[model samples]
Every structure is written in structure tokens, then in C-alpha cells.
Target chain A: MATEIVLISLLKILVVVLTILTCVVFLVYIERRVSAFVQNRVGPNRTGPYGLLQTVADVVKLLMKEDIVPRNAYKAIHDLAPIISIGVALSTFAVIPIGDTIELFGRQIKLIIADVNVGILYILAITSLGVYGITLAGWSSNNKYSLLGGLRSSAQLISYELSMGLSIVGVLMVSGTLQLDKIVQHQTTYLFGWLPAWNMFLQPIGFITFVTAAFAETNRLPFDLPEAEPELVGGYHTEYTGLKFGLFFLAEYANMITASAVITTLFLGGWHLPYVEYVGLSSFILSLVYVGTFCVKVAAVMMFFIIIRWTLPRFRYDQLMNLGWKLMLPITIINVLLTGIVLLILH
Target chain B: MGSNGKIIRKKDLNFWQRMYIPEIAKGLRLTITQMFKPKVTYQYPDEKFVPPPSFRGRPVLVEEQGVERCVACGLCSRVCPALAIEVQASETELEKERYPIKFEINMVRCIFCGFCEEVCPEEAIVMSNEYELVFTSQEEAIFGKEKLLTPIEKLRPRLEWLKNNR
Candidate 1:
């Protein structure tokens, strides 16, 4: 039975990995479309309908292109960089519960690949491994620009991670569980009558802090200083090309989707909607709807991210650092205290 | 209250302010407004956008009264920074007269800088509002006289202006 369960988990992991890969490819297309619309320009529309398969063409082009490893690059580490990136990215989705369990082929299958108690911690560890790729890619390139980008990315991640981790402490406190699925189960109630089952209502400060730190953690604007063009040509991936470079690209976007999913699960009440119980809907249809809801929420966060990219000017390195350590850290600490005080009073 | 200088403004935020209630409320209101607001987005191809008149676009060659108004001066070609314009002119049946027989503009190379239009002596080539010039193949995009020239019937108003003057 244990062996069978392991086999089932393996199958689920395969599906989840494929899903994440597909999302990364399609997300690029979505970003281009969204950015184009905002700038009053028509984006890619040649490959497929509305240029849906443009990413596929791009993938082909990148794959066919020359694979140049810089002369001075540390061969083994450079060779292994993208593998680490994609490995971490693909594996991080293991803990992401896309939906509730569904019964199929006389077997019950949980929506996620793994049901780990330390799900959030697993995510943090996996995501942090992405910096290895960036650092190695930059150091391998032996370019000044690439070196700066690598250093910037590493420093930025470490700085923002404090606030990010702190922000989630509130959620863990309120929900009283580190397991994400149970956290979802907890969001099935109302505050008064009108208020929905969203932690965003109760822990607004925590939500803000979480999302703000999340942007920085993902190296997204206005915290995308690591890959800031005009200053650093192509950043850490400057020397990478073909399928190796493709891995880094995939990981970046996959991390983005992961971050979005994490945010949705933590603060926006995961798949739980208030007053709308999953009673009559068949588990299959229910999961389809649940995954659909999950995707929609993720897409919305992704859109919000892109809009901020367009709307907000990129912060200077100092401003980013100061914002992370000074403003955000203090705010997160305060949010934690407030959450504790509220929880204590309510009890 | 007396030791105002010592205490930082943020050191003592009111409950509502510290809670970020006002700002979050404002953000929530704005999001709701955005939800109801008619989307300014226009879906291209499926729903073609009507670009404003001043929207600068592709350079179009104009043939007026069945005669190319280019004058073969090469001003548009020479002045074009992108060097996307190629004009091959030949003498007409009319004595000592030269008109562009083969006018081609490679849009793949054209920057749409509007310099070509500005430098045109006879206003033969001007930027058009038709932005749907994307082509799959290079041969199709490197437009020849057949595909390049806007018919005189299409440009009667502008042609008549040229006719009334020159």
C-alpha cells in the first residue's frame, strides 16, 4: 500500500510538473499580451490564433540557437546551473494543493503531489535554491554586468525574505496549522456575516507585507533591480543560450506562478469561498472548478504584478534595500504583533 | 504633545492609520471602480481599433491620376533613415518625362520615422493609418508597385489638391 501510494504520488508529480511547464510557456504569452495592451501596441499574433503558440516558436528558436558557455566559466557549476533552477522550480509545485481529492478509477487521488506538513518551508527552501542558478550563471559568465546582477539578486532575495517569512507567521498563527490544505479548510467561515472567508480582511497588514515582500523575493518590479536592463544587459543569464538558457527563463516564470499560488493560498483563502460549500458538485467537477478558481486567482495576481511593472518605476538599489530592511521589516513585525493581539482578544 | 520634535510622526500612528484602514479602503474602492469601469482595451484583429488621425504609421506611396507623383527625386528614399524605400523610375511615353514605374518599399526594414513623408517634394509618399501590414513571408512584405501604390480613386481628394496646385 505504501509503495502504491508512492507510485501514485510520482504520477501526480509528473502531471504537476507538466502543468507548471505549460503555465510558464503560456504565462510569457500572457505577459506580452498584457504589456502590449497597456502600451497601446499589438503583441505577438503570428504563430497561432492571437499568437497563442508564439511561445512554442520561441522555444524552438531558443533551442536551435547556439549554446555558448563562456571561456572563463567554471565548467561544472555553469553546466549544472539551469538544472538546479528548473529542478527547484518543478519540484516546488509538489506542495501546491490545486484542489480537494477526487475519486477516479476506483482510487482516491489528492489534488496535490505531496501532502507535507512543512509545505510552506519546502516552498521557501526550493525557491531559495533559484539564487544558486543566478549566482552560478553570473559567475560563470565572467562579465561585470552578470556579476553585478548575481550579487544584486542574492542580496535582494536575502533582504526581502525576512519580511516575507515574517508576513506568513501571522497566517500560521491565525490558522494554527503549517499544512496548506488545512489552512484552506480554516477559511470556510465568515467574520461577521458580510465579510468573506478571506484572511485579507482580518490580516490586511500581513497581506500587504506578504505581497510586497513577495514581489521583491521574485525579483519583480519595482524590485527587479537584479535584471534591470539599460544597466545590466541580460543579467546573470547573459552568457546562457539555447535549452540551458531556456531552463532559467522557465524557472523565472515558474517562480512567478509559484509565488502567485503561495500568495493565493496563504492570504486569499486558497480554494475556499465563503458561503459556497463544495457539497453537490462531483469531486472531479469540483476540482476542475477549484483549479479554475486557483488559476483565475493566480492570473489576477499575475496581472496585478504586470500592471505594477508598467505603472511603477523600478526602484533604485538603495531604495529597494531600504524599503525591504527598514519599512517592510518593521511593518511586518508590527503586523505580527497586531495579529497576535487580535487573536488573543478574540479568544 | 510638548515634546513634538523628539517623537517621530510614524512613531505614534493612530489605530486607523496604523491599521492601514484608510489606504486599504481607498485601494479597495479603486479596485471596485476599475472592475465596473469600461475596459479601455481594444482587441486587435478580432476587434480592429480606430487609431486617432495623428497616429503615425507605415509609409504609403500615392499614385494620382494614373501617374506616380513621386517625381523620382529620391528625396523620400535618400532622406529615409531606415533606407526602406526603393524607387526605380523610367521615362514615360511623353517626351523628356520620367515617372516611377516600379516603386517598392520594404516594410521589414522601414522604421516608420515619418522622415520620408516630411522630405517628399510632391507629397507622393505619406504615412498611412493602415497598420495591418504584417506579412508572413519576406516576398510579400517587400511590396512592389502592384501592392505599394494607393489607387488615384482612393486618393482623389489629395490628388485634386495636387492637381489644383501643380
Candidate 2:
């Protein structure tokens, strides 16, 4: 039984890692294509059909390029930075439930890799650690631009993290659980037999705050001041080359995928589509459907991320700081307060 | 400038503008709409862009009936700002007094300025619509008479456009 459990855990880990990595690769492809469409240009359709293998080609190119390390750089930390970034990005996905339990060979298998009770806290903690990677990379690079980028990233993380944490407090109050699976289950019920009881409907402000903060956390455009190319010249990864640079790039897309998943799990009802249970499908089919629903939701969110990146210009440093502090923080705080009061009155 | 003739400081944004959500939404809507619009990018390489007659690409020697139209007057060589063009005149038996014994254009130095084409008294050099130029070595970038010559029929559109517009 112990052996079986161990095998299953290993299998889950392999599946999750493979899925997330594949998603990251394709997300890069999607980002380029979507940006092209927005700009009225054809981007990267030459590598393979519709540029499906462009990221694959890009990966090969990065791997083949010369790996250069500056003579004055801190070798150990500089090497370790991308690893830490990618590691944190991948590990955060372990707690996110893609689908509910499914029966296989007379044993129920849960889709999540690690079903930690403190799932939300684990995500928050792991995400916060991502900043360390950027900071370390900057400090170790021995380049002034890298140092500035790292500084800006760390400050941005700290400023936005407050509102991000507070924003989710409203969701937590409504769902009354920190486990991601529980949050999704909480959202399965319908209001007036039509609308799914998604947290998005209940806590719209929380949804907005969570999404904006997620964008900042992912270091995407508008909030991508750290890697603001016009100013910082590739930011913390300025000194990075070849595979090291590829790792940072991979970590970024992975963070984006993870953020999309987190948002889906928290506010958009994860694997539960509205009225899906009413279809009366078999257990196995239903589980497959759940996975599909979750993927579709995540894809939609990812498209939104891409669209917003191309649509909006990068925020000014002061505007970013001001928005994080003066606006998002207070709004999230109020949302938390409102949710708490309502929950208290109802109970 | 304001109607009062005083330089106006930028007007302060209202609460809605300060909030930025509405403006962001409008921008997003515009971009989403644009995503469905026709893309302006060419497939390139597979589908070569046929440039208009007015397009200035690389300077080529216009060859007519298996011979260059150049009288080898050396005007193009003199007018070239980058000194990209080099011409050597030699005695010819043809009606034209001289033909270039050696002509080379260093594409690396050629700025596609159309000066060589403009300064040619014989209309021997014209900017043909052949923009795809890749050289593996510095030595290879210097095009000899063979590489510089283009059939007059292939350059008809450019010649006609030059005739009408120049």
C-alpha cells in the first residue's frame, strides 16, 4: 500500500510537471501569436505550421548559443538565480487541483500533486520567494542595469503583494477554506438555478484585485517595469545568456500559467462548469470533462493576460507604486471588510 | 496653447480617468477589435514582396541585349557618397566609345541612396527591387559586373516608373 501510494505520488508529480512545462512552452507561442494579431502582424509562422514549434526552435537555439558569464560576476548566485525562479514557479502548481478524484483500477486518484491543507498560503509563500531569484540575479550580475532591475522587481513585489494577499481574503471568507479543492467545490453550487456560485460574482472587487496583482506578480506588461526594455535592457537577466537566460524566460511563462491556474481555481470555479453535474455523465467521462473545463478556463484567462499585455502600455514607476498603495490596498481592505460582515450576518 | 494665449498646463484628470479602469477597458476593446482585422504582414521568403516601381532597392547595372548600357563615363563612381561603386573604363568596338573593363559595387557600403542610379548619364545603373541581399563574408559583399548586371526586361517596371516620375 505504501509502495502504491509512493508510485501514485511520483506519477502525479511527473504529470503536473509535464503539463505545466508544456503549457509554458505553448503559452509563449500563444503570446507571440496573440501579440501579432493585436499589432496586425504575422509573427513566427515560419518555424513550423502556424509557428506551433517556434518555441521548440527557440529552445534549441538558446541551448546551442554560447553561455557567457561575466568575469566580475558572483558565479554561484548568478547560476543559481534562474534555477530558484523556475523551481518556485513549478512548485507552486503542486497544490492547484486541476480536476477532482477519478476511479482508476478500483483506486481513487486525486489530480493534485500535493493536497496540502494550507494550499493558498503555500502558493502565496512560494510566489513571494520568486522575488528573491530576481533580486539575487540582479545583485550577482555585477551590472548596474541588472541591479536596478532587481531592485525595482523586489519593490514591485512587496508593494503589490499586500493588496494581493488582502484581495484573496474576501474569497477565503466566502469559501471558508484555504485548500484549493475546497474553494472549487464551494463554487459548484448555483444561484437561482442558473448562475454558478463563482467567487467572481460574489467578490468582483477581489477578482479585479487578484487579477491585477497576478499580472504584476507574473511581471507581465503594464506591470513589467522590472524588464522595461526601453530603460532596463532585459532587466535582471541582462547578463544572462544561452540556457541560463532560457531558464528565466521559461520561469516567466510558467509563472503566468500558474497565475492563470490560481485565478481559475480561486474565482472562476476551477474544473466545475455551470450545470455540468446536471448532464448525468458517467464518473470517468465527468472527470475528463472537468479537466477540459479547467483547461478551457485557464486558456481564456491566459488569452486575457496576453490581450492586456498588448493593449496597455507599461505603467510609469510612480503610477505603479501609487496604484498598488493608495488604490488597490484600500479597495481590497474594504472588500475584505465587506465579505467578513456579510459572512458574519448570514451565519 | 489655450484661447487666452497662455501656455496651458495639462488638465488634471477627473476621478474616472484617475481610476483608469474605463480607459483601460476602451483600449482593450480597441485591441481586441484590431485582432480580427486583416494583418499587414507578408509571409516573406515563401511569398516575396513585389515592391512598387518607386521602391529603391539595390543598385544594378542595366543589361540590354546581352551588353551593359554603361558608356563608362565614371559619373556614378564620382557621385556615390559611400564610394560603393568602382568602374574601370576600356576601349570598346561598339557604338558607345567605352565599356567598363571592371565594375564592382561593395553592397556592404552601398546605402541604397539611388545616387548611383540618379547620376548615371547612360541610365546603366538603376535601383532594382531586389532587397534580399545576404553576404557570408566581407569579400563576398563586393559584387562584380556579373552580379551587378540585371536583364533590362526584368527591370522594365522600375525603368518605366523612373521615366515617368524622375
Candidate 3:
């Protein structure tokens, strides 16, 4: 069992890291494509056959590009910030179950790095650490724009984090377990033996709040006041260059992938296909199918992220805060209370 | 409000409108339809997009055994619509007339018109539809002789055709 656990853990880490990289590369491609389609333009069509190799070429270029550190900047922290951000981003994936375990080479392997009893909490805490990089990078740069962006991101993250945590608290309460795999298992059975087991139906309010919070956390559009280019210029990494700049971008997409994974795990019933029983399919085939199903769900959420980004205008920083604290928070709290009462009576 | 001076508005709620259920069902129905419908995207690697008949793409330089067919003629440079093409000439190993020694196209400047093809008597520089030109920097977009030549020109029969004809 220990050997199996060790192998599973290794596999999880490998999958998470690779997926993070692959998803970031494709997410950029997809975002460009979606944005192009929206604006009625043909996006990236060159690189490796249909421009699929564009990201790979970009990575090579970035790696080969000159590394320039500003003379006035705090060299140590400026260098360390991106590392911290990427570290935090990668760490959050440890708690997420992409899909359930299946027989592999005659051994069962779980799809999570660590199925900690407090997995949800662990993910939340780890993700929160990502802000440190932005703050440190901003402070180190000594640029006014970077400093202002860093401060805005900090305040924005802090405000939204509260409501985001609260929304998930209801989910944790309902599931009664922190282990993501177990939460998913609990959600596998239908609510009325007909309705599919997913939190989207049960906790609509929480789902909305959580999705909104994710948009805020990712520093994406509408909530993207931090990098409001017209106002704040290039945001926290305005002065960053070469691999350092690449790392910031890397962390952003990694966090995005993590957010999508978290959404899948929490609200979308990670890897659980509606109206389809996993009991009948062969274990190996079932795992593959589940992984495919999980990817489709993540892709939909990613597309939704892109679509909303294109559709919505950037919210004023104040408006963003008001929506988070005044509107979303109040509605979510009432939802939690009402949901709690209903669950209690049902129980 | 109905009896008092203040006016009260009556709201109508249909079964579907009363809840978000109808909207969600509609969304699901649309997604289902799209899933079954032919994917609009051209899967470029395995299944390339079938270019339209007049699709503008790769630059074709006619060759006799991998050597360019221009015979040092400067007509293409004169006829280039955007004035973006540059060709330098030098005597080939054949010890006959000079051919292009350095050939390049400034893709950033080139309007992608088939002007060069129309101007060429040698049937050189026809634009094929195999365009996948993605680059992060401006420098990468500039094409040299190596990149300007299509992969088809390197194939055995075409190379053979050029050599035998020459």
C-alpha cells in the first residue's frame, strides 16, 4: 500500500505539472482563437503546423532572450517573486482530484497527489500564497505602476477571498469531508435518484460566487483591475523581462488551470458523467473516459472564462469590491443559511 | 399598494421563467446539438484545412534540380505589388546565365498578392495554400530562401522534374 501510495503520488505530481504546462500553452491558444472569433479575425496560424507550435516557439524564444535586471531594482526579491508564484500555483494542484483511481499496470492509482482529509482547505491556503510573488515583485521593481497594480491585486484578492472561502464552506459542510476524491464520491449518487449528483444544481448560489471569485483570483477580465493596461500600464510585472516575465505568465495560466480543476472538483462533480454509471465499464476504459469527461468539463469552464472576458467590460476597482462584498457576499451568506436549514430538516 | 396612492407593478412568471431551469435546459440542448454537429474548426496537423481554390499561401520558386528558375531576370522585383521582395543574382554552377543567389520576402510588408506569380514567365513564385506562419517576434516573420521554398519542391519527383527539364 505504501509503495502504491508513493507511485500514485509521483504520478499525480507528474500529471499536475505536465497538465499545468500543457493547459497554459493551449489556454493561450484557445483564448487568442476565441478572442479572434469574437472580433472576426484569424488568430495565430503559423509556428508548428497551424500555429500549434507557437507556444513551444515562444518558450524557446523566451529562454534564449536576454535576461535584463534593472540596476535600481531589488535584485534578490525581483528574481524570487516569479519562483514563489509558480511554486504556489503548482502546490495547489496537490489537493485536487482530476479523476478517480483506476487499475494501472495491475495496480490502482489515485489521481491526487495527497488525499488529505483537509484537502479543500489545503488548496485554498496554498493558492493564497500566490499573492506574495506579485506583492514582492511590485515592491522590488520600485516602479509606480507596478506598485499600484500590486496594491490593487492585494486588496482585490483579500476582499474576494473571504466570500470565496465562505461559498466553499457550504460545500465542505454538505460533503462532510475534505478529501476531494471522497467529496466527488459522495456527489456520485443522484440527489433524488434521478437528478445527477453535482453541486451546480444543489448550490447554485455558491457556484456563482465561486466562479466569480475564481475570475477575480485569476486576474482575468471584468475583474482585471490590477493589470488595467490603460490605467496601471503593465501591472506588477511591468519591469520584468526574459524568463522572469515568462514565469509570471506561467503562474497566471497555472493558477487558471488550478481554478478550473477546483471548479470541476467542487461544483461539477469531478469526472462524474451524468446518467452514466461507472460500475459497468471496464476499470481501465472507465478511467480514460472519466479523464476525457473531466477535460471536457474543464474546457467548457475555460471557454466560459474566455467568453465572459470578451463579453464583459472591465469593472472599476471600486465596483469590483462592491460587487464582491456588498452583493455576492450577502446573497451567498443567505444561501448558506437557507441551505443549511433545508439540509438539517431533510436529515 | 393597490388601494393606496402608491402604484404596485404585477410581475408575470411562466413555469420556465419562474426558475432558471428552462434556461439551463436550453443551454444543455444547444450544447448537445453542437456536440453532434460537424466541428467547425480545421484540425490542422492530422487533417489540414482544405484551402479554397484561390487560397493564397506558400511561395513556389520553380527549380531545375533545386536551383531557382529566374535565370537572373529582375522582373519579379519590378512587378512585386508591395515592393517587398528582394532577389540578388550570381552565376550558378551550370556556368550559364546568373540565377538568384539571395532570395527573400518581407512578410510584414508583402500584401500576399499573387503579383510575383503573374509576373513570372518561368512559372515561379506561385502561392500555395499551406500557410501556418506563427511567430512571437517581428524578426521571425521575415522569410529567407530556405523558408520561402515549400516542402513540395524538395520532393523527389519535382526535384527530378526540374533536373530533367534543365
Candidate 4:
């Protein structure tokens, strides 16, 4: 029985990692296509049939390129930086529950990789560690531009993480659980019988704060001060070459996917479709439906991320700092207080 | 905040503008609308761009029937700012009295400036609509007479364009 459990768990891990890596590659392809559409240009249509194999070609190119390590750089940490970045990015998805449990071969299998009780906190802690990869890469590169990028990334984290934490606290207060699966279960209840009780509807301010903070945390546009190409010239990963650079690139998209999944799970009701229970499907079919629903929701969120990247101009460094510290921080704190007060009055 | 010579004050912004959320929404709306708009990309090589007569692509030597119109006057070499054109004159039995023994255009140095075409006395060199030039080596980029000469029929549009526009 124990061996069977171990085998299933191992299978689950393999599936999750492969799915995330594949998604990362395709997400980059999607991002490029979306950006092209926005800019009124054709993007990457030559690789293979509407550029389906562009990411594969890109991977092959990156693999074949020369891996140059600077003579003045710290060799060990420079090599370790991308590994740390990608490791943290991929590992954060372990707690995300894609769907409810399934009964197969007369035994139940939970969909999540590791069902940690402190799922939200675990996510926060792991995401915070991602900054160290950038910081260490910058410091070890022995390049001034890289160092500046690393410093900006750390500062951005410090300013925005507080708001991000506070925003999630509102969701936690409403759901009354730290386990992510329970939070999703809490969100399954409907309001007025037609409208699903997603956390975004209840705590709109927290949703906005969390999403914006997620964008900053992912080092995406408007908050991508760390790798501001015009100013910092590829930033912390400037000195990295070949697959090392590819790893940083992969880690970024992976982080974006994780953020999208978390947002869907938290605010959008993970696998629970609106009025899905009314279908009255069997357990196995229902689980499949739930997984499909989760994927669709995550895809929608991912599209939003890509759209926003092409839409807005990068925020000035001071503006970024001000938005994080002055605006988002206070607004999220107030939102938490409001949730607390409402909860106290109700119960 | 108004220390710069521009003298823009931060206090001028109202509460909504200062909040920035509404502005961001407006930007998002603009971009999303743009995504639905028709793209202007020309898939080059698959669908070649047929440039107008006024367009100056690579300069070519005009071949009329079985002979080139070039008298090898060397004026193009003198007029070329980039010094891209080189012509060697030799005695010829043709009516022009002198024909180019060797004509080479270092395309790497050629800026597509149309000066060579403008300076040619015999109407031999004119800008053709052949813009796609690919070379794997520096030597391959240097066009000899075999590469530089194009049949007048293939270059009618550009010649007609040069006639009307110039």
C-alpha cells in the first residue's frame, strides 16, 4: 500500500513538472504572438506551422550557444543563480490543487503534489526566495548594471511583498483557512443562487492589490524595473550566457504561470465552475470537468498577464516604489481591516 | 516635484488621476482594441513587397538585347560617396568604342544611395526593385558584371518609375 502511494505521488510530481515546463515554453510563444497582434506585426510564424515549434527552436538555439562565464565573476554563485531561480519557481506549484480528489482503482488520489497545511505561507516564503537568485546573480556578475538590477529587484520585493501579504490575509480571514484546498472549497458556495462566491466578488480591493502585487513579484512589465532593457540592459542576467540565461527566462514564465494558478485558485474559484454542481455528473467525470475548469480559468488569467505586458509602458523606478509603498500597501492594509470588521460584526 | 524647468506640479492631479487605476484601465482598453485591429505585417519572401517606381533598391547594369549600355565612363565611381563602384575600361568592337572589361560593386559598401544610377551617362545603371540581398561571406557580397547586369525587361517598372519620377 505504501509503495503504491509512493508510486502515485511520484507520478503526480512527474506530471506536474512536465506540465509546468511545457506550459512555460508555450506561454512564451503565446506572449510573443499576443504582443505581435497588439503591435500589428506577425510574430514567429516561420518555425513550424503558425510557429508552433518556435519555442522548441529557441530551446535548441539556447542549448547550442556558447556558455561564457566572465573572468572577474564569482564562478560558483554565478553558476548556481539560475538553478536557484528555476528551482524555486518550479517548486512553488507543489501546493496548488488543480482539482478535487479522484477515486481510481478503489483508492482515492489527491490532485495536489504536497498538501501542506500552510499552503499560502509556503507560497509566499518560496516566492520571496526567488529574489535571492536575481540578487546573487547580479552580485556575482561583477558588472555595475547587473548589480543595479539586483538592487532594484530586492527593493521592489520589499515594497510590494507587504501589500501582497496583507491582501492574502483578507482572503484568509474570509475563507478562515490557510490550506489552499479549503479556501477553494469555501469559495464554492453561491450568493443569490446564480452568482458564484468567488473571493474577487467579495473582496474586490484585495483582488486588485493581490493581482498587481503578483505582477510586480513576477517582475513583469510596469514593475519589471529589474530588467528594464533600456536602462539596465538585461539587468541581473546580463552576464549569463546560453542555458543559464534560458533558465532565468524559463523561471520567469514559470513564476507567471504559478501566479496565474494561485490567483485562479484564490479569487476565481479553482476548479469549481459556475453552477457545475447542477450538471449532476458522476465523480470521475466531475473531477475531469473540474480540472478543465481550472485550466480554462488559469489560461484566461495568463492571457490577461500577456495582454497587460503589451498594453502598459514600464513604470519609472520612483513611480514603482511609490505605487508599492504609498498606494498598494495602505489600500491592502485597509482592506484587511475592513474584512476583519465585517467578519466580527457577522459572526 | 516642480524643480525642473518644465514646472509641472504633482498637486495638479485630482484624486482619480492620482489613484492611476482608471488610467490603467483606459490604457488596457486601448491595447485590447488594438489587438482586434487588422495587422499590417508583410510576410516577406512568401509575399514579396512590390515597391513603387520611386523606390531605390539595388543599382543594376541595364542589359539591352545582347549588349550592356555601359560605356565605362567611370563617372559613377567618381560620384559614388561610398566608393562602392569599380569599372575597368577596354577597347571594344561595339559602337560605344569602350566597354567595361571588369565591373564590380561591393554591396557591403553600397548604401543604396542611387548616386551610381544618377551619374551613369548611358542609362546603363538604374535602381531595380530587387531589395532582397543575402550573402554568407564578404567576397560573395561583391557583385561582378554577371550579378550586377539585369535584363531591361525585368527592370521596366523601375526604369519607367525613374523616367516619370526623376
lDDT of 1 by residue, A1-347 (tens): 99998899888878878888888888999889766666666677778898999999999999899988888888888889888887877787788788777778998888878789988888787888888888887887888999999999999989988888888898889999889888877776787776776878778888998898888877887788878887999888888889998988898888889889989888887776555553677667776777778888888898787766766668899988888898989999998998889889999
The TM-score each candidate achieves on chain A is: 0.96, 0.99, 0.96, 0.99
Fnat for candidate 3 (0 to 1): 0.00
Q: Identify the runs in model 1 with alpha carbons over 4 angstroms from their true place.
A: A282-284, B1-166
DockQ value of candidate 4? 0.80
lDDT by residue (A156-210, candidate 3, tens digit) is 9998888889899778778887788898987888977788878888888899889
Candidate 1 chain B weakest ten by summed lDDT: B28-37
Candidate 4 on A81-132: residue-level lDDT in tens? 9999999999999999999998888879888988899999999999999999
Clashing pairs in 4: none
**CAPRI quality of model 1:** incorrect
Q: Share of real contacts kept by model 4?
A: 0.97
On TM-score, the candidate that comes out on top is 4
Q: Candidates' DockQ values?
A: 0.10, 0.79, 0.04, 0.80
The interface root mean square deviation of candidate 3 comes to 6.9
* Stronger candidate by TM-score (3 vs 4): 4
lDDT comparing candidate 2 with the true structure: 0.93
Worst 10 residues of 3 chain A by lDDT: A33-42
What 10-residue stretch in candidate 4 chain B is worst by lDDT?
B1-10
Question: Candidate 4, residues B1-166: lDDT per residue as tens digits?
Answer: 3557577755688899877789888989999999889989888778888888888889999999878899999999999999999999998998889999899999999999998888787789998887888999999999999998889998888878777876
Alpha carbon lDDT at A259, candidate 1: 88
Cα deviation in Å at residue A172, candidate 3? 1.6
* Pairs of colliding residues, candidate 2: none
